[model samples]
Target chain A: MAEPVLSIRDLRKSFGALKATDGVSLDLRPGEIHALIGPNGAGKTTLIHQIAGGITPDSGEVVFLGEDIGALGVAARARRGLGRSFQISSLAPEFSALRNVMLAVQSRQGSSFRFFRPVMKDRSLTEPAMAMLERTGLAARANVPAAELSHGERRQLEIAIALALGPRAFLLDEPMAGMGPEGSRALTAFLDGLRHEAPILLVEHDMDAVFALADRISVLVYGRVIATGTVDEVRGDAEVRRAYLGERP
Target chain B: MSRERAINLLLAGLLLSVPLAALALGELFYITLATRMAILALAAVGLNFALGLGGLVSFGHAAFFGIGGYVAGIFSSHAFNQTPLFSWPFEFFGSDQMPAIWLAAMLISALIALPIGAISLRTAGVYFIMITLAFAQMIYYFAISWPAYGGEDGLSIVVRNGFPGVNTAVPLIFFLVCYVLLLAALALFALVRDSRFGAALQAGRQNETRLAAVGIAPFRIRLAAFTISAAITGLAGALLADLNRFVSPSMLSWQMSGELIVLIILGGTGRLFGPVAGAMLFVLFEFVLGGLTERWQFFLGLILLGVVLFARGGLIGVLAGKARHG
Candidate 1:
């Protein structure tokens, strides 16, 4: 197999007395959807935070595209093609969906420092942002402020923003977190399509969506990965079933 | 351009021509007062960088503004007396040249803001407001107690500091200097507002987590903006000192900070000319009201409180309404 696009080894982080992440390890390859699933408070979000360059791990190395990016900041990491979506919808609520995506595009294109030239007239940046919105099925909602968007549309807009950054990989934290059944099904299909474009590390709670779209799944329990495999392998694994699936039953 | 932007431009042009008209009418003192308005507006322009775009709401900007004034005053005083400020190893040098003083003022304010911003940035909401206010009070006390440069009494510039090719004492020429700087400041504000760094700054204010998700560090962005904002305000302080030929502890007081905020709120925060309009209105109100009543400031404070409590948008906001698009 080709070299893994992202590798996390023995990652650990603690908050006060709580060990949020304990020896978490995973690897993601190009063009694959890797879903991380766990019970509440399992440190899935913490692990994602460390990987996305938001929080520094107390121990372990995060190697992305052959670089040990422990010291780089969030924007520097993004400049290197690491994009993240928040578990809680995190768009500029007052900004129109189009402008929100356009900002991400603006950061990647050139210095957003051109001031004398009017921003609204800057087609060089806005055109691509609009196109990305079109790709994400948000063309109809482009003019609406993000705050006005339905929860499902905001999730789609979040994905569109990540896409506009032209990321090499996506770290999406609960993209379908607050969506209804219809929203979840629609998002799962959209994410399934994205698997062909870039490797995605999806942290999600929707079991049905995870089972439907993930190329591979890692079950995290108490900050440690108990299993990483295809649907059949993970579903059949006794440890994952006992630790997570058993509770569902 | 849109009809709205075109109208905004026309208003700016009309405002710009006022001091020139004052000069033509031979109202020299009024010209000087207009110069004062521009300089104060320039300080608000700096505050705009932090308050308007970055949403920092710094109440300590008066500290930087006062520091800039004191730097000019101390330098000119030492130059006039022809003595080293202190008997340090290298000796503290002094210059009466306004550019030299202004540059030094900018450097000092930026350096000071680094520490102030680092500490204040740790907290958000009301905590940020209190911390900034506390820092400004600390500076104000220091200035009041120092007793150097006359402290509460203020230091005066015996002669107006020299500017190249201009009679710096002449009201029209001085007003021109202030006008040019105000425009330069407005241009910088317009540029920074549209820049990528500006985008990240505003985003940081809107939703810090979202900014972090996009790989932008809110702290660093805020720090850069804070330092630049302080530097701009410091430049204004130096100009103010030159205009009045005085630097007093009052410049560092909390009241000055409140007035700066009032200027932005009155003009409309975030708009380029908001501070300018606020400054003009403030000066006009002070002049006109002071002429009409003995207790004008009481009325002015009442009006300002009304604006803050009742007015969602300042003058510009009321005039321009909402921005239709980005």
Candidate 2:
């Protein structure tokens, strides 16, 4: 019933002939996990990109924090409190985990133009960065570079980075991709608690995590949302079962 | 201690000691050669801020270097001639003072870098490299065609600029002045490398999209790095002109830009001591090889080829171990 923190309306994108995202509309409210699941090449990532300002929608509006952010760039949107993570694990591989998180913390604090003081020695930056790392269970690996982190740890670090941004809403694109069962379970529990802090527009293929964590689910098929409902309602929907949840439901 | 730290300390020691040894041994010419290495190292250090850290491979840095040289040439020329640079506004007099000239050089170079970096940072990869090179060439050709300051023949100063309490005209004193400045620039480089700005700049270099996701604009960070880098390189250029008592369009040439990059690559791209090591090696090769034969550059080319093909990390990697970052 709360006003949506992020609202995407009639978002459309095309690559020559194929409409990657056609007339897609979605809303993410506070304290809710809105999972967007679809089969391969269903334009889930394209829709997420439009919302995160990575791609310009042919005709649509992405309203964030009561402002039409369709014209903003990725950094501008991020500064305005929209957090995102890549399915392919986008991180500064050369930087230590703590430093990577510290970058996000620095962005939140104030201007990063302060050049004279050594960031490594600054307790204000390091303490908050360490706290984020601790929250992600990567406290011990804080000194390790992102490139040296395990796949699971890198995913966790991504969440830690996003959390440091103090985002009003999170547009997480497949955060649990390439994780094992144990990692997925752990991350699912973490996401369950994370939803209380900010709503998540999760685009994931891991149905177990999605079914367990999503307060509401939206089935995207061929650049369109075929169904949006609770776990039981979406499970019983014939179109979702035929198009996506086929034999499982 | 780590091998990298050990090698870095050894390099600092060698650069400092060798010059002092030359001065003590009355090898005045060797002092001059050492001074050349310091000045060249300083220039490469400036480029390293943008190229190594920010991943901005600027091929037009010679514009900053030449601008610094011209500042020295123009200011000292006016002072020597007892002529006001201009009487229209408020009668601006020229200065032979090193501090004033260094300030002018840095300010002018930063001003130039602002517009150039603003335009160049809009592109990335090879396009960024070519656009910066093209801008440098524009400045180079401009300096050549404009005949007021001697054009292709270049401007020459009768005496080197003055430094407070130091007889800069003396070879040893002048070398000392340059050495001190090089050390200061090296300190600045180290400070920036560990700063928050440096973190964002390096992150931008590694993954621009990720940097943007964290709410830091890659273009702004890179432009700041580029402008600061140009200012440092410009200061080195002024020192170089003062050392030679000459300034020419050649200082602005594309070859000069290539040489600056060579110094960084030959040493180690992102390593702190990389520029110093590369500059020393380069000057030593030029001196030793030139004494042997006129076609010494052919052998230098061969050595550079070997380093590029076999030792991708340059002399620093071979001696100091792997760079902190790939």
- Among these predictions, the greatest lDDT belongs to 2
lDDT of each: 0.86, 0.91
| Model 1 docking tier (incorrect/acceptable/medium/high) | acceptable
User: Which one wins on TM-score?
Assistant: 2
Q: How well does each candidate reproduce the native contacts, as fnat?
A: 0.45, 0.77
- The DockQ-based CAPRI class assigned to model 2 is medium
Clashing pairs in 2: none
Q: What is the DockQ of each candidate?
A: 0.42, 0.65
lDDT of 1 at B291: 97
Tens digit per residue, CA lDDT, model 2, B246-308: 999999999999999988989988878889999999999999999999998899889889999
Candidate 1 stretches with Cα past 4 Å from truth are: A12-19, A55-61, A71-73, A109-124, A140-144, A180-186, A222-224, A238-243, A246-249, B1-7, B10-29, B82-97, B288-298
| For model 1 chain A, the run of ten residues with the poorest summed lDDT | A110-119
Cα lDDT of model 1 by residue, B1-326, tens digit: 76556656765676667777877787777887788788989999999999988889998899999999999899899989888988678777588887898899999999999999999998988899899999999999988878766877888998878787789888788888888888999889888887667777777777877776665667888888889999999999999998999989899999999889988998888778888889988988889999999898898888878877877578787777754436
